[model samples]
Every structure is written in structure tokens, then in C-alpha cells.
Target: MADPTRAARPPGPARSALHRLRGVARRATDHPRVAALTCRLAPRSVRTRTTLAACASVAVVLLVASAAVVLLVRANLERSAEADAREQAEVVARLATEGRLNALLPLDHGTDFVQVVDAGGRVVAASQNLAGRPAPTRDGDSAHDLLRGGDHQSVTTITAATPTGPVTVHVGASMRTADAAEDVTTAALAVLGGVLVPTVGALTWRATGRALRPVEAIRAEVAAIGDRDLHRRVPDPRSDDEIARLAGTMNAMLARLEAAGTRQRRFIADASHELRSPLAVLRTQLEVALAHPDPRVRSDLVAGALEDTERLQALAADLLLLARLDSAGRTRPQEPVDLAELVRHTATARGVQPHPVTVHAPAAATVAGNPLWLGRLLTNLLDNAQRHARTAVTVRLDTEPASGAAVLEVTNDGVPIEPDDREKIFERFARLDDARSRDDGGAGLGLPIARDIATLHGGTLTVVDTPGATTFRLRLPATPTPPAGG
Candidate 1:
């Protein structure tokens, strides 16, 4: 028994067939050999791939459109033939209703073949061409096909009420003209599509090549550039397109690489020179101490040698710090540091200096950073201030009102740094004639290290202009202070 609650559903044969086809395709793609074959057959060149894709798309569209046109033209021609046949059939039916249809029907030889049959299915009247032939019978009133003289005919039938009884009228029109027209249309479209598809593919190939020409030139130029010739740049098309932007971007990258290479070479040379000075001094002191026999003289020479060794060690340490700072990917643990407290503690730990160091931190200015590096930054700033100050070095810690960033300023009452030399002072191993000297026990890396630390904490350190004094300002993003006792 059928379940009354179940809804009627269609058995979707087309959907099931599509699902099966998809499964077959998936399995074929999954097969290792088939996948390998597909990969091997795939075109590697962008131009070839684009051309083939364009051709395939055009082919599919043309094929579908051609098929639709043929179908539509055939349908229209068949409808026209059927309509003519129906009109002829109605004319015969009207003659039969008036009892005027003759046993031998008149044939115009252009309209259609006509015949009349009685209710007993006997052909009583017919056109002169179909006089001896029997009329065809079908179940419906729609147009149908009949074979005559090796050609198909579109036949339409109708019924008419006569004075004696009900009779049937049949009319037929030849389908040769419609068939010939449909065949010609299909052949023409096929030829046109064949020509058009190849033309489209050729045009696509040319366009793709032209578009990628700049990219190819860039690749060749970059390939030709050697490590020593970083100054050479790729050609720019100067157009406002992606290729032009790519060329510009690549040129900019080359510029950066060239600058970095220059800096690297200079750094190596400077490092070598700086190392040689202390090494030569130490060697000289060691030779003097070894040659002398007097105990006091030997002791003094040994002390001098030891001092040079200390200077070499300090320089080596600074170089190592700079190397670590240059590594962009290195990460350090961080914690919130109170800028005011750090400034005070760093100054106090430095002990006494030639100049009086004053701290003017009145409030808590908190920032997130590695405390060790932050301390070193502050210590370096204080040392620089003391080294250059005439009377006093002032350290001020406060937050910027507008951005709420913690700002630390170290000021010294020294000869103001020249506007031009201000930025140069922060360069590694940079020295000015008045400020930096070999005898001052100062490796010019102190300020640079301080700046690197500030930058590592997402902050900046720079020298700000001040009257009759030099000021080094440090700015860091501020962190919220914790609630009391929390």
C-alpha cells in the first residue's frame, strides 16, 4: 500500500546523470597518472593559455548560438508550412460543407494537396495530383508528416459538418524548402565559426604578448644585473598601469638594496679602522713593557696596555649591539616601565659626573618596553649630556599633551650642535672635531644605540633645537598606569 502522507516527487534523471558525470571527473582528476598527464599537457606560457581559453569560450558560444538559430529557423519554416496547409484544408472543408467538393478536386499546384473523406474513412474527393491515392489518418488535429515521391510533406487535417454527414479534409505542403534552408544555415554558421574562432585566438595571443612584454623586459633586466652593479635599474614604460607601477616598485627596491650595500661596505671599513687603532696601541704598549727591565716602567706600560684592551673590548661590545639591532626579525620581551622612575634611577646609578645632573620628573609617565634597553638608552643620553655639558645636564620626563606619548628630554648647557651636524651625530661611529676624540674614551656608537633602542620600542629619539644648549628628545607611546593597589 502507498503511504498517504508521502509527497509525489519526480525522478530527476538529468540531475542524477550530472551528478554521476561530476563524480567521474573528480575520480579522474584524483588519479595520479591522469593528474600528471593533465599537468604535462597544460600550457606553461600565459599567452598560449589565454589564447586557448579564448578560443574555447568563443567556440562554445558560437556552437550554441548556431544550434539555436538552426532550430528557430526550422521551427518557423515548419509553422509557416503548417499554416498554409491549414488554410488549404479549411478551404476544402468549406466546399464540403456547401456540398460543392467535386470527386476530382482542382489543384492550383502551388498552395497544397487537398482531399475530403466521409465519416466511414473513405476518400470521396481529392486533388488531381492525389486522385488515386488514399487519404492518411492520424489520432490528433495537429500537423504531421507524410512521405510522397521520396519527399516529406507537412500535413494538417480538419473536420467539417456537411448537409449529409461529418467529413474530414486534409491538406499537405512540401518540407523540401524548409529543410534546404536549415541545412544551408547550419553549414554557413559552421564555416563562419571555424574562421572566427581562430581569428579570436590569434588576436588574444597577440594582445597577451603585448601586455606581458614589459614584464618580460623587467625580468631580463633584473636577471642581467649583478651584485656589484646594483645601480642599474629596469626600464620604466612611464604609463599609469600595473606594469608601470611594478617597474617603479622594482626600481625603488633596487635603490634600497644599493644604499644598503653601500652602507655595509662603509660599515666594514670603519669597523676595521676603529679596531686597528686600539690593536696598534695595545701592541705598542705590550712591546714597550716586554723590552723594559725596570719594574715601575714595566708596570706603567702594562697599565697602558690594559686600558687599550678595555677600549677594544668596549668597541667590540658596541659593534655587537649594532649587529643585533640591525636584525629586523629579532624580538625581545617587554614590560611596562615608568619613564620618570627609570630616568631618576639611571641618573643616580651613573654616580658623579663632571657636570651636575638634574632630574625634573614630576609625574608617572609609563611606556611599554624592554627595561634593560630602556635603561641603556637613558644611560647613553645622560653620558652624552655630561660629556658635552659646561655646567649642568637636565633630564626631563613628561607626556605629550596632544598625543599622550611619554617624552623624555636630556638637555645640556653646551655649545649648541650645528644644524647640519645634528643628524650626523646619530650615525654609527660618527664624530665631530669638538665633541668626539680618541682620548675622550667615547665610541661614537652611544647615541646611535640609544636611537635604535627608542625605535625598537616604537619611539623616536632626535636632537631638538634649543638656545645656548643642545637637547636630545626621546618620545615613546604612553601606557596606561595601573589603578592604585590593583
Candidate 2:
């Protein structure tokens, strides 16, 4: 059978309550308004935040450490007090056992209260501090030998089995002195904490500021750079760190932007000059026709004006196409185009020129691209070849077996381009000295536009060096055509 006392205790509450409370506290800290408020109150810089978080963490750790120290010191002091009281009580017990309780009267100190009591719970003798007082412990529960009253005093009792009966000796040590020492220690710790936290915070702030000085300097330098002066770069610390890497990356980006800006300025200047030439010719022809009334001169003036107008219109269209290509979005839909067929058609459509063109194309060389752009690319390549060729221009279209890429080559049997000038030929407004005249080169944007179109289709148009001929080669990703039945 179970004891009545054992059956009376209630079951404990579930342990998950503590976990739920912790979860709630975590969610509360994550609240948006609280986060916003914290951000507002704290410094915005990363250095400041890191420093403050470190200081706060240090302060918490210090506080916990000080509390632990205080607890340990208090525990030790209490143990020492109890030990002293126990020793005094043991001494008193010995004297009482020897029947020499009266001998302790002159040796007594006022701080420690000692008493000798009989089994009857009556005080037989007492020290100077407890003179005339009854026994502190009675029979039963209080008669048990123990230590108690540790706040202002520490009392210990020990029973001595004397010749007559059991005698209890009680000794109480004053806790006033130990408590005073604890107070002094606690006060000192509090002062140290107050001084240490602020000192650490200030030092952290200064150190962090010093570390971030280079970043601020870089920011100021970059900010001072205007659109016209993208050539300026941020100063690098040269250390292999995140900050140094950031500076390097920024300088690289600035370099690209400067190059692009220079290209844009040159493009605009070239376009303006090209436009002015045609407009001036058209205006001069119109003025000449008004001054002369002859039909032959009038007809000549009309033809000249028409030629200038056509050139102007072509230039405007090319500029518009370039602008559209430069935009971030694509307006044309991508589809599988027969590059071989496209090249053959563009070559056949062009009028008879100084050169005879020959087309060598496979039946089905397909590539993925906008059909219109691909046709324009072929047209530009053919036109360039036709103008430069002395007697013949050969157009070849086929798929490369290794890479499975569609290759289109326009080879002109003309004066070969210099090795050094091959890359420069694809730049907008780039013209060779021999073809600088308006009649020979049509605005010099055809090659650049063709290259841009090729790039849009994930392809490349490059001038390949030949033994005694000029060859413009185009490469596009090849796509397999579906079977007729499928």
C-alpha cells in the first residue's frame, strides 16, 4: 500500500510551456515595428553596428560573470560562517561535557553567542551576549542539532552526551561583517561595469571608424566623378580583402562605362557629319536648279537631290535600327531561318555591279534568328563584298561538321584588308582610307549593324584573313530541320 503522503502530491505541468514562451519571445523580437525602431535608434554603418553588437554581447557576458562571482563569494562566506559557528558550538559542547561551562565566561567574546542547555530544554549557562536568556532551541523539532539564521546571524547547535543527560551547545556568529564585505564587493563590481561598458563602446566606435575610413574616401572620390569624367577611378588599398576587391570591381565597371561613353560620343559625332553631307548636297542641288531654267540642268539637279535624299533615308533607317538593337528588350520573335536560302536570295536581289557574284550554298543550312535581321546581315555582307571586289565575290553557306554551326562566308577578290585593321573594320563609322569617300562607303554603319544582328542571334560576324582576298565570315548556331512526314 502507498503512504497517504506519497499519494497527495499533484502531477507537474508540461515542460513545453517554457519552450512556447521562448518561441513567443523570439517572434516578438521579429516584429516589423520593433525592427524598424531598432534600426532608427542604431547607427546605420556596418562598422557601428558590429561594434555595438559586440559591446552589448560583452556587457551581457560580463553581467552574467559578475553575478556568478557574487553568488560564489556569498556561498563561500556563508560556508565559512557556518564552519566558524560549528567550531564554537563544538568547543562549548566539549566544555559542557567536561562540566566546565563556567570556565568559558572570561574567554567569551561579545560577537559570538554561546549557550549550554540541558535535556529539559532549560538554559544551564550562556555567554555574555546571551546572558539571562533562555535556550533558543526547545525539545522535538528545535532540539535537533543544526545551523540556521544566516541573514544577520549564523546559529549552530550540537548536543553533548554528558554524564547526567544530553546537553545542547548553541553558538551564533554575527553575519553583519560578512554582509558588509559583500556590499562593498557588489558596489565595486557595479562601478566597474559602469566604467567598462562605455569605455569599450567608445573604443569600438573609434576603431571601427578608423577601419572604414578608406571606404568613405572611396565613396567621396566616386561621388565627385561626373558623367563627363568616368575615367576617374577609386583608390585601392591593395590588401587582399573584401574592401580591396570591391574597389577593383568598381574600377573595372568605371572603365567599361568610360569606353562606352567614348563610343557613344564618337557615334553621335559621326552620324551628325554623315547627315550634314547629304543635307548640304541636297540643298546645293535645289539652289542650283532654281537659278538655272534649262530642262537638262533641272533634270540633273532632281536626280542629285533624289540620290542625296535616298542616302539620307538609308542612314536614318540604319541609325534607327542600331538604336532599337541597343535597347534592352527584343521586339522581333526568334525562329528557325534557312540561312543558305536567305543568303542566296539577298545575293540575287542586288543589281549588277563592278563584280560578278557566285553563290555556293547547301540545300538546308538552318539557324535560329529573326528572319528580317538575318536577311539584313546577309545583305550588308554582300553589299560590302560587291563594293570592294574587283572582278568577283564568292558567297558560301554550309554547316561546320565539328561544331554543327552554320557558316556563311562572303569572299571578295579585291585588295585584302590589313591584319591590324580587321578588328577596327567592325566598329561604327570605321572606314578604310581608300573607301572614306561618300560614293565608296555608305555611312560605314553596315558592318557594325551586321555584327550587332549576328550577336543578337548568338552568332558572330568576323573578317577572316585570306591569301589575296577579303573574306567576311558569319557563324550561327545550327538547328536540325524536322523530317517531311513529322
Candidate 3:
């Protein structure tokens, strides 16, 4: 027995054909070569497309309007011609009633075909245009009537009462006249379109090109700017328009870029100088040890080399930390950190023996931050204070209930930083020391890194001036305490 569970197979031919067609369509749409060819065949420039579209739109509108006018004029002309013919026929019928039909027969114009039929259905009188034609209508059958004899022959007929009896009148103007009028209208419209469309297209092309000229100039200027020459700016027309605004905005951006480039170059030069000194000293010490044969001098040289190596390592670590801080989307786990305890710990680490450092925190001030980075920030602050202090360093932690922030202030009895130099202290590789020596100032990145860390933790580090003291103040958003009952 055949297996009843077997599923029936679908038909192959129609499905296969559809699948092949779909595959072809996908290839045509998705393939790069196909897309490139399509682009090549299409209008590539905005000017070309705009001109063509404008011309086509005008052409379509003119065509539809001209068609409507031609139809209305043709209808009116046909109506007028037919009405005139009928009126002439009525005149002929009246003449026939007066018994002067023979005089009016064989009319002069020959444009209208007129015939008069008697009550007995006999062709009694006719115009020259219908010389041998039979009666176009039956006896007494003419009342706004159209009579067609051949494919192209037609007449408008009407019946009127004479003195003897009623007679039929046949009248028709040729179709050629109406056709000729429409033909002339169409020919004239064609000629107008031929002239007008090209003119519209040419004007559109020129207008679009003129409008985009400013943008083209901006693009060229931007393209010509090199890494070494970010100071160059695009030309501004100074008009109160979009293009002018765009140029102004671009120039502002270039100015900012140039400033940033200047800072970067300065930082690199400073870093190179800092690194070169240690490296040169280390190399020279090694070379001196090689030249000398004394054991004590070799030992001193090794020690000096180790010190230089440690300084290099410290500088490298600081650079890496800065790099990480600058990277996007880098975050660390946050927890409540006691600012008072951190300040005391950093002050102790920096040695309170020599400088007589003191701390005052009446209440616990807590902030949400990474403990490691917070510790680094405290260490940097304490180090800076100890380095600049003349007598003692004082660490103070307090909470501002109004702003809900924890404030840590490290004050030293050092010379007050100048008003202009205070802001410059936070810039990378900036040193207020006139010598610009790394040995005395420690790579000049400590304050910048400390400020960056404080900012990352939603805080700020700034130098606050007291009467005779230089104080570095750090402010961090305070973590709120929970309800007592809860």
C-alpha cells in the first residue's frame, strides 16, 4: 500500500517560472552594475531634471488648454454654419411659396447644398451644389433634420408651409470648413509649443545653475582645504538667504576646527618634548655607564635610568587614562562614595608629616561615582595642593543643602594663581611655570585629567580664591539619604 502520510508535491513549472522572474527582478534592483546602468540612463543632474520637468509640465497644460479651445471653437463654428444654412433654406422656402422658386434655384455661393421638396415628394428646386441630387428629405418630414446620403455627404433639413402646401428644405455646409479650422488651430498650437517649450527649458536650466553656483563654490573651497590648512573659509555672499547662512555657518565651523587643530598640535609638541627629555637622559646614562669602568658610577647610572623609566611609565599611564576618558560610551559601576573619607585618605597618602595637612568634615558627604576614579581625583587634588603649598594643606568636605551637592575644597598657602592663568590650568599640557620643565611640574596633565574625571562624575573642579589662600574646590552631586522610617 502507498504511504498515506506522504504530502502531495506542488506543481513545478508555474512556480519555477515565477521564481525565475522574481530572481531576475531582484538582480536588476539589487546588483551594483544594474544600479549604475540605471543611473547612467536616468537624468543625473538637478538642472537637467528641473528643466525637463518644467518644460513637460508647461507642455501638458498648454496641450490640454489648446485642445479645449479647439473643441469649443470647432463646436461654435459648426453651429453657426448650420444655423446660417437653415436660415437660407427658410428664405428659399418662402420664395417658393411666393412662386419664385426657379429664380432662387442654382445659388451662387455653391458652399451650401440646398434642396426643396414638394408635398408629393418630388425634387422641385435645388441649388447649383446639388444639381443632380435627389430630394434629401420625404414630404413634410423636415424639422431640424440631418440627412446623410453618402459617407461624407450630409444636410440639415427643415420643412416650411407655402401658399400651396408644405415643402421640405434641405441645407448643409461642408464638413471641410470645420475640419480646416481645427487643423489650423492645432498647427498654430504646435508651432507655439515648439517655440515656448525650448525657451522655458533653456531659462529653467540657466536659473537653476545660477542658483546653485554658490553651493558649488562652497564645495570647491571645502575640498581644497587640507589638514595643514583648516583656517581657510568658504566665501560668503552676505545676503540674507539660505546659501549665505550656510556659508556663514560653514565658516564658523572651520574656525572652530582650526582652533582645535592648533590645540592638538601644541599638545603633541609638548608631549614630544616631555618624552624626549627622559629618553635622552636614559640613553645618555646608559652610554656613560658603558664608557666608564667604575662599579659605583655604573650603579648610580642604573638607578637614574630606573627613575627615568618610572617617570616615562607614569606619563604613559596618564595618557592612556585620558584616552579612555575621551572614548565614547565608557562607563564604570557607580556606588555611594564618602567624600570626607576619600579626602582624608588622599591627604594621608600624600604625607601629612611635612606640610601639616588638616581635614575638617563635621558630617558625612556622599556622592555617586566610581571609587577608583574618585580616589584618583582626590589624589591629584592633594598632590597639587602639597606641591604648591608654602606652609600647610587643609582638606574640607561639606554638603550644600540648597544645590544638593557635596563640596571638597583643598586649600594651600601658595601664591594665588593669576586670574587669567586660572582657566588655562585645565588645558592639556598647560603649565604656569616659566621654565616649562617637566621635572618640576609633572607632565602638566594632572589638573586637566582631574577636571575631566570630576566632569565625568557630574561634578566640577575649579580654583576658588580666598583672601590669601589658593583653594581648589570640587563639587559633586550628592546622593540623597533615604527616609528614616523606611
Collision count for each candidate, in order:
0, 0, 0
lDDT of 2 by residue, 115-229 (tens): 7888887878777655676565444445223323334776777889877789877777777767887898889888999998888888888988877877997899899999988
- In candidate 2, clashing pairs total 0
For every candidate structure, what is the RMSD over all alpha carbons to the true structure, in angstroms?
5.6, 8.4, 8.0
Per-residue lDDT over 327-355 for candidate 3, one digit per residue giving the tens place of the 0 to 100 score: 72446336988777877776767676557
Q: lDDT (CA) for every model shown? A: 0.85, 0.82, 0.81
Question: In candidate 1, which residue pairs get closer than 3 Å at backbone N, Cα or C atoms, i.e. clash?
Answer: none
Best by lDDT: 1
Q: What is the TM-score of candidate 1?
A: 0.86
Cα-based lDDT at residue 408, candidate 3: 85
Report the candidate with higher lDDT, 2 versus 3. 2
Model 1 lDDT at residue 134: 63
Q: Model 1, 1-486: lDDT tens per residue?
A: 886544354358866988899999999989999989989998999889999999999999999999999999999998888888787888888988998978987754434577788888788898877778765656743324442545678777799999989998777788888999999999999899989999999999999999999999999999999999999999999699999999999999999999999989988888899999889989998998899899899999999988888899988988988887778444633598887898988888777768788899966877888888899899889988998888999988887798889888999998899999989988877888985578763878899999998888888899999999999999998775679999
- List runs of model 1 lying over 4 Å from the truth: 1-38, 102-111, 137-150, 328-334, 480-486
Candidate 2 residue pairs in backbone clash: none
Judged by lDDT relative to the true structure, which candidate is superior, 1 or 3? Answer: 1
